[model samples]
Target: MSRVRNGLIGRGLIPVWLLLPIVALFAVGYVLPLSQLVLKSLQSEGSWSLKSYLEIAHSPTFFWIVLRTLTLAATVTLICLLVAYPLAYMIARCSPRVASLMLLVVTLPYLTSVLIRTYGWIVLLGPSGPINKTLLQLGVISEPLQMVFNAAGVYIGMVQVQLPLMVFPLYAALARVNPSLTKAAQSLGSPPTDAFLRVTLPASMPGLVSGCTLVFLSCLGFYITPELLGGPDDYLIAQGISLRVLILGNFSDAAAQSSLLLLAVIMIFLVFRRRIAEELDDSSRFDDISPLGATASGLAARRPIVERASLLSHHVGLRIHEALTSVRRPLLRFFAGLALLLLTLPFAVVIPLAFSDAPYLTFPPPGYSLRWFSRLFSNTQWLDALSFSLRWAGLSALLSVAVGVPAAFALVRHRFPGRLAIYLLLISPLIVPHVVMAVSLFFALAGTSLIGSPLAFALGYAIIGAPYAVVVTIAGLKRFDRTLERAATSLGANQITILRTVTLPLLLPTLASAAIFAFIVGFDDVVFGLFLSGPNATPLPMRMWDNIRLEISPQIAVVAVMFLAVLAILGLLRLFVGAAIEGRRSQAKT
Candidate 1:
């Protein structure tokens, strides 16, 4: 039996079974739909043609919307980089305690729903919101200015939604910068300003490029923020495509538009992917090919006054640097403080607003009550939507783990034909924009009479959620020690026994966290929910999207707060599980 098992394993038949689930999910949920989408885009009058593409190309509306999306995405990327760079730099420079505190502040907004974050802007910029009301009270303006439902609101919401994305990559880049290089520049008589630009800034470029690419791509497909907060004439590409599908029932036109956007995403990623992969794949690249020494030398030579004065006075050269450092540190703190406030204040304001009895959105409520929470439980539609979201979360958690765990195992424990291709295919859902994926899946599901089916939505959610699950599981597997498994095998245990008794228990903590993350990813989904969900299976996010659009209501605030609560609970659960796992690991080591 042992010989047969070893032979099967040696032949790689076990890995084939291990990978079967993910492959099947990929083929049915992703590949088939994308293929159908391409076919749909090419079909014209029941015959193959580029008529849809030509029509979309010629349409003024399409052109403006595409231009708006590109412009907005680029602007948001730039703004997020500018705002987050200082914060990231400050965090990187700070002591570990301070840095950890700052990171917690930065990460808080991420834990909250993106829908809720957009709602935060609505509360701030509304006619009856705090900013306008305060201004009116102070006689700064006689009439409330229209801040919501405009380009300003969309920009604010999108920037806030995408800010954390930019900050993390930049922080990683900045934190990894060799301090010795900067010190060497200072020693060589280069001013702090020149050293930063020539040495430190260039070193941080990888993060800037990665963050900008990610934020821009995400901004293009964003639907909830723009749809909820944007004005009638402030249409973007995703909005335009959705309107075409929802209003005119024109899947072909929407597909063509989506395909165009997809092509752009592919093109942009091709331009930057090499840099991203280079930095990620080879951590030692910076150490091997550091430009800091070269940059500092050039800049030091360029500064004649500083070079000449180095003999006259060591302190004289540092005069500019001292003054600059003294002022710059405070300015960094002040702006970072403001940015943190901007991140945290909205959530703080909204939590109380949910408890308010006010009829409309107001900062200082007329009164307080639990009516909204009651309504959340009482309203059949709300309950139904919440129920479906919970169901979606559970099934997606299961499905993601089902595929993700084995995929992680295969990728980590084995190397075989098409390994890299398989890995790329598994993560390809992330490569395309969500709106494009939604448009493609929507049409593909329609052809099979599964457009509004809950099962179809679950599969769609699994595709998106699995990538994250795989990532989390892979991270844990990399940290796992295989010695325990070998010990179990030497004790006469079979492959199944070794895996079941040793591997599975050790991986449980990471699996649990991955499952919770997968749940949240499915639960808060709006774009796919918008395209695939309907009257029968209205996910909570889709319902929230509807509520915000058809009418602004307090119930949405209730839902948002509920989202935060669920995430908080899940976060605590994961922490507790982590502690337990650590305890057991310690016992095993002893």
Candidate 2:
């Protein structure tokens, strides 16, 4: 038996037991559910039909909504790219310490929940909110502008939330620009501005394109932001799907919309497949020849008309070049600072409004009080939602880690046929947008009696959360030493005993990190809550989503502030506490 086991191990198949559990979970959690959804979508009146798809295709409302969603996503992508370019340039050129600090500011949007960040935008952009109040006091307008609950609010909120996604990628691209190219350009009598335009800018296109593709897809899938901030007239595709399912009970219609939307995403992804790889790859090698880019660079590097005329004209051109170069660096830093300030403003606005003693959401509080927070704690409805959200998050985290760790181990250690297929199946929940997942799971589980239960929420979230844990566990496993496991196997220990005594203990910290990530994802989720939650089983984010639409209150502001504070604590723990522990262990080892 030992010889057979060793032979299998030598063939890179010893750690294969975990593969079955992962495949089974993926089948139940994703493949079977989504397959049923696709089958239902193709059937109508107990017969296979394209009626739903045809109806949606011919409907003007569907066309208008989808077009609007695409337009918003493109606009947001452009805004993010334009804003992040200078910011990324400045950061890339800064000292490492300064860049790290600034990067933290850029990361604020990602740290807080999307639901919380969107709420912050509401308090800042509403008619009676800070932007309106400032404009009113400044006499910029005769009356307060209705910014929230409209298209403008949706645009602003989407851009703000998605900007960080753009910046970090562009910065990574810029940081990798070879300084020697710029130096060579300068050595050839080019000004700093000319050097950057000719050399540095073109090299960063990969990162910019990657960021734009990512932000476009992410914005196209907007759920809670547009719902909370957009007017009745400003529905996006995701919002429309939810309304069809929850309001009209039109699962067939919703499924058709989801299928179309998924197709659109797939097409977009196929178009930019190379650019999207920048998310994981070290650097994008832009060896593709672009006649347009080459022409533009040649044009920009060409001298002004006057400079081609005379010596005096050339002297004046040199002065102009010096002047632009002189101000360019400072200008880049200033605007970059302003853009980063906008990233922090959403959460900054939440703190004062949360403590406001005012009857409604107000900034620069007339007086400070804990009234809203007290109300947050005392309300039984809120208390119940909080309890349910926490329990579901915990259980979902456990499920995610249990499912993901095995999957990661099997993939890392095995050399089996159909390996890539299983990997893709496990990670499909992440690739498929949240709207599709929610709609498909809602209809599939609604076939059973699980739709309105907390268990439904956990299962749905676990399916999504598993991908995060899997990615993190895979990273940790790549750093793990296989020799230790082999040594244990040779010491008369079975595979399970080796994993218990050696593998699990070694990867314990990584598993904890995966659990924490799963917890955050499950807790912050609003889509599953939107589709599957009952009134009695509402999660905290769902409560926030409801209050924004049905009841306007300062209490929501309190919750947003709480989210900020709790996330800050977690960030601190992840940074400082983890570092301290690792430091102590290093010292002990030494």
Query: In terms of TM-score, which candidate is strongest?
Result: 1
lDDT scores for all predictions? 0.80, 0.78
Pick out the ten consecutive residues of candidate 2 with the lowest summed lDDT: 278-287
> TM-score for all predictions?
0.88, 0.85
Question: In model 1, which range of ten residues has the least summed lDDT?
Answer: 276-285
Best by lDDT: 1
Tell me each candidate's RMSD, in Å, in order. Answer: 4.3, 5.3
Once superposed on the true structure, which residue ranges of model 2 sit more than 4 Å away at CA? 1-11, 14-19, 270-323, 409-426, 474-512, 584-590
- Model 1, 1-590: lDDT tens digits are 99998987776876788889999988888888877888888998799999998898788877888888889999999999888998999888899999988997887787577777887788888888888988999999999998889998888888888898888889988897877777777788677664676567777777888899889888877888898889988898888788889889887888888888878887777687665444223243444435544355434434445445654776775686667766876788888887777778678767888899977666777899998898789889889888998987789888999899998888777768876567756766766777788887888777665778898779888988898788778778877888878877878999889888878888888898789777877888888887787668789888887777777677878987888887778767877887887788678767
Error of 1 at 491 (Å): 6.2
lDDT of 2 at 455: 80
Off by more than 4 A, model 1 = 1-16, 136-143, 187-195, 275-322, 447-449, 479-498
